[model samples]
Target chain A: MTRLDMFIDRMVSQRACLDFAIAETALMGGPVFELGLGNGRTYDHLRDRVTGRPIYVFERAVASNPASTPPEDMTILGDVRETLPQAVGRFGDTASLIHADLGGHNLAKNDEFARLVSPLIAPLLAPGGLMVSSDRMYFDALEQVPLPTGAVEGRCFIYRRPTA
Target chain B: MTRLDMFIDRMVSQRACLDFAIAETALMGGPVFELGLGNGRTYDHLRDRVTGRPIYVFERAVASNPASTPPEDMTILGDVRETLPQAVGRFGDTASLIHADLGGHNLAKNDEFARLVSPLIAPLLAPGGLMVSSDRMYFDALEQVPLPTGAVEGRCFIYRRPTA
Candidate 1:
């Protein structure tokens, strides 16, 4: 396969996992969270799929496509190190779905960042909530769930907080 | 991306979609079908994942690894064009999950076969039953559902029979 095929697979897999998570959490009464805005395509998709729940985006800055940008009230601006902790204080463990695609092209850097953010993200999910990430996350409390069909194994990762 | 990466993506996507469909149809009171059980890898996977549902395998021959072969009572041997229609006579519109990975390496051949079998497969599904195919199938009555995230478009396809 060509590079284009590889890219398509990643995009498709990401969409499949996110859609599954969105549907899985539909009945839960909590908000959704997007860890990075980037071009905000996934965030836009999330907004379209999620009903009766607010979608909050955590980003360093608002540099996404205008059509995909989140409303001011839903955008949490700052370095995630500071902002994520603040979110824990405000929202506690009530996020029904959280999606993160914060990895850089550099694999080593991505791993380090995943390690740093794993704990911060772990505390934000509601029981039975799901976390979808482009990079593998290190979470002690959350169990890594199997990816839904059509998802490349290493291309995407899903974690679920135990209901207990 | 290398050819190996592409192969891995397809395999992963196939697994993900089948798993999703299996979960989606779990509550329905119908059996599962596996079309074209080559090497029986997927047939084995289906047997493991589906609970309380009998799995039926359709094939022209039974040449597969001993570990993966289906029980004789569950295997239907003959050309699919002949056997599939016979199946409809015996079991009409009650398959909860039907998975087909019948395509070969040749794309044109795969598409042609998909067209030929789509109708035969369509009548076997229960309302709300799911059909997961490695190739895009042409079905008049079945609605093509959106592929879940992480699934590369054109690499796999999912069709659902209307619940009504």
Candidate 2:
């Protein structure tokens, strides 16, 4: 495989996991959350797949393809440090699905961000809801679930809030 | 991306797809079929994930890792052209899940084989069941499905038998 093949695998896997999550959580009544709306490709995909639910996008600055941009009402314009906590207060544990693709080229930096953000993201999920991320997250409450078919093992991670 | 990375992606994607298919079709009642059980790695994985269902392996020869080989009662020995027809006679449209990873390194040969074997494999699936393959298959009766996450596009394919 070349660099192009690797990239294709990542992209295909991401879409596959997200699609599976959308279908699995279809019956659950709650909003969806998208962290890091870079280029808004995944967000656009989500809008196409998910119905009858709000998809809240968190972004510090809105810079994405014009056609893929989320509506103002649905986009939360702020750093996640402030926005995620506030989201918990407003939405409670009601998000049926949350997707994050926040990793950068720096592995250490990405890991640090994953650690800082994992706790903030955990409480937003409904019991039995899923958290899909491109990086590993440390969540004491959420248990990691097996990746859906077509998803690369380390390329994407899925964690579920147990329905206890 | 290197060749090793590509191989890893293929293996992981294969497992992810198989696991997803297994979980999705768990409620359906029928046997599982493994076509071309080379080395029986996938056969072993299937045995581990699927329970209370007979896993029939179709092979031209019996050589495999001793620990991974299917029992004599479940192994169908012969060319697929002969055995697949026999399978249709014996099992009909009652396979809950059918997995085929029969492709080799030769693209042209794999494509030819896929074309030849596809119709033979199509009639084995139960209504609403899934077929996970390592190569693109031509199925007139089965509809191609979206691949699950972690599965690289073109690295694997999934098809479903629609319930009438």
Candidate 3:
């Protein structure tokens, strides 16, 4: 089996929702950026869908990880916080999607990170572009606080740039 | 077992994704709209989740079919195409998240219906509210297309309104 198949089998077993989010973003059309490019899971998930558009991933050690790196043509890898400026320079306002699955290590710092990164990604988003993050920052609060019927859990918070 | 229990079981068997979606939306603080209120399945999934906000539903014939009517307090039901004016007036700008599992009939008109209702729901969404729909729409496409690694067909599309 191919590496993609092995990764997919693991994801299915773990029931990762990232694939769903990626597909939804792709259906909306995307040149996505993945923060916390853990094992390059989402990069693989989105590679085919956003064929021509480069999938930029930010992992502090991506360059050193052979298993996670893609063909030179499909992906760009670097540290998101430090390398974002260079990424913006290379792409020049073309990013349409952003995914952050950075593990629990940085969860508490999300608001701070968002403050910095949101502006960078915001300008690059096409008309209906989206940013999807995996961490359920509000899961506990939502359970304690009642919501309207038809409410669900585990939706990655999606931020959309205004379409005008 | 209570009606809710039975409904939850059914959802677990057939619409687990929808159930998860509703829970996640609620946790994220949503005012959700469900377009196809079939036998009140989605409503029941979110019954406990509904707190201060109203859950709006559009069913073609909930009034005629007692089984389809959601519990009195949780849902507002009507025809989407014809009664949107009244529905929007009643719900006002509180319709943040919109979901439709209307099967083939509704799926066929998704693009048109989404265009029509998006404006009304757009204003109601809190900064990160979601709009979701499920159908067999992606089944054939998913079969023909090989998803890149780490991807599986979640078979749902979620759209988020632009937040100002």
Model 2, B115-140: lDDT tens per residue?
99999999889999999998899999
Docking category for candidate 2? Answer: incorrect
For model 1, the superposed segments whose C-alpha errors exceed 4 Å read B1-164
Among all windows of ten consecutive residues in candidate 2 chain B, which has the lowest summed lDDT? B1-10
User: How good is model 2 by TM-score?
Assistant: 0.51
Lowest summed-lDDT stretch of 10 residues in model 2 chain A?
A1-10
Q: How far is candidate 3 from the true structure (C-alpha RMSD, Å)?
A: 21.2
Error of 3 at B31 (Å): 47
lDDT for every model? 0.87, 0.87, 0.50
Chain B TM (all candidates): 0.96, 0.96, 0.57
DockQ (C-alpha) of model 3?
A: 0.01
Tell me the spans in candidate 2 whose CA falls farther than 4 Å from its real position. Answer: B1-164
